[model samples]
Target: MMRGFDSYASIVFFLIGIAFVWESRKISESSYGSNVGPDIFPMGLGAILVLLSIRLFYEAMKAPKGDSDGKTTPDYKRFLMIAGAAALYAYYLEDIGYVIGTFLFLLFCFQTIQRGKLVTSLVVSASFSYGVYYLFVQILEGTLPGFPSWLQ
Candidate 1:
């Protein structure tokens, strides 16, 4: 891994996270009389991003100074595949619903990053997708497109 790249990325991510948090604050609180505001997700996500970026920066700095100039080729095919999947996920989300769409997307991404271990990938993807859906819809009283009618 390129040490310089990681350091630079950490800085960029830190800034982006800060921006997310800052911008999310502008959103109006409480939509349609619901306790959960539209800003809640973005604010929480931004906070998490900021924390993660700080950790990334710390790890990047603390890690040993490895090859600072190792130029590895980017995998275009995998990039295209993941990009295609993301686009399809966005396009089909309303129709397919959040849990299934997110699960499929995460599964595709995890498998793309590392093939094999289908069980691990499937379980992780499913758990995260369902957990998020449950948390948002039930606990937070937030609405999300649930399973498609076909599945229900």
Candidate 2:
């Protein structure tokens, strides 16, 4: 089971690395000043992820096999719940706006999937969503979704 988890994590990292590498190619050097290009960070991070994945894969391969002692299997229901919440978030992101969608996502994650306290989950989710919104919209001056004219 441990080895399986390691293998899965390694493969995920490997795929992420590949994605980063592919994305890096799209960033043109001319887009950035002579100092640095957008591709540089992506390529560097991709290489690091690839190296880490390789190391993890090797370690997992060398790890000892499972013991005779019985071990409990992972909770598939919980996994499904988390996956469902993520899917919901992705589906509603554009319609609900980032802040509201993210808050609802976090609340669902903490309350339904993680089984956290109601008050704690609500507070944390609201704070995190607001913080992210403020950072992106106010500090970074990034465009965010606004109420649609029709909705107004």
Candidate 3:
């Protein structure tokens, strides 16, 4: 079952990588005077993904069949929770402000994955959210939603 799943995943990822590489060709070959183009990164990443997927396929094919007949139950509840949180995060990111939305989403995900260690999860989530905001807005001179307009 694991082997079959891996094989399917590899095929899917391989196709996705091929699509990325094909679409990347639509971008301009170079930017300004620089020889390296914006498309290069995506093309290169796609090639890497293709190679990795091929490797996965090879490993899956070579794997010995196990005798264990019992199938493991998937954690669908956890998956649904994380998926819902991610959807909400994407929807509310701009409206709620990056820092607050990201922090809440990360905190929720962390707690959902592991119930205990509330303080640690809070600290890590807060640090990541604020750190990204500071790095992008203050340090890099890039704009991100800082706080909701009503707060200002």
Candidate 4:
């Protein structure tokens, strides 16, 4: 199963690399000089991805057969919880404002998922949210959504 997963991932990466390489050719090269063309970064990244995917594919092909059987499967419940939380965060982010939404999301993850104390989770979440807000909005002069109109 693990080898299968690796093989699938490698194939996906290989396809992505091909797409990037193809798309890079369409970018206008007029703005960038001869040496540093518009396609340079995409082409470089695509080449690297292709090479890494080939290496991963080869490794997966040569890996021991029993490794997959011995390894434990990932927890679906935890995956679902995290995904659900992320979806919820995206939905509520603009409405609640960045600080409040982020605080609530972190608190939910810490308390519900990580089984942390309510007070500790709340404090940590609030502190982290405030720090991020200060760094991005206040210090960097980046605009973030203010308190929702309904809340005002």
Which candidate should be chosen as best, given lDDT against the real structure? 1
State the lDDT of candidate 3 residue by residue for 1-152, as single tens digits: 45667788899999999998999999998676444567877998899999999999898888778722236767899999999999999999889999999999999999999999999999999999999888766775556677999888
Worst 10 residues of 2 by lDDT: 29-38
TM-score of each: 0.88, 0.63, 0.66, 0.54
**Candidate 4, pairs of clashing residues:** none
Candidate 2 local lDDT, 1-152, one digit each (tens): 44667778899999999899889988885442233555767898998999999999888878778621236677798789889889988887788887788888889878776665899999999999989778756775555674334566
Question: Model 1 Cα displacement at 142 (Å)?
Answer: 0.3
C-alpha lDDT score of every prediction, in listed order: 0.89, 0.78, 0.87, 0.81
Would you list the clashing residue pairs of candidate 3?
none
Query: Which parts of model 3 have CA positions greater than 4 angstroms off?
Result: 21-70
Give the Å error, residue 100, model 4: 0.8
- The prediction achieving the highest TM-score against the true structure is 1
Q: Can you write out model 4's per-residue Cα lDDT over 1-152, one digit (the tens) per residue? A: 54768888999999999899889999875342233456667888998999999999999989888657237887788778878998999998888898888988898888657784889898999999989788756765556666678888
lDDT of 1 by residue, 30-86 (tens): 899466999988888888888888887788778778545356877999999999999
RMSD of each: 2.4, 5.5, 5.0, 7.8
How badly does each model clash, as a count of residue pairs?
0, 0, 0, 0
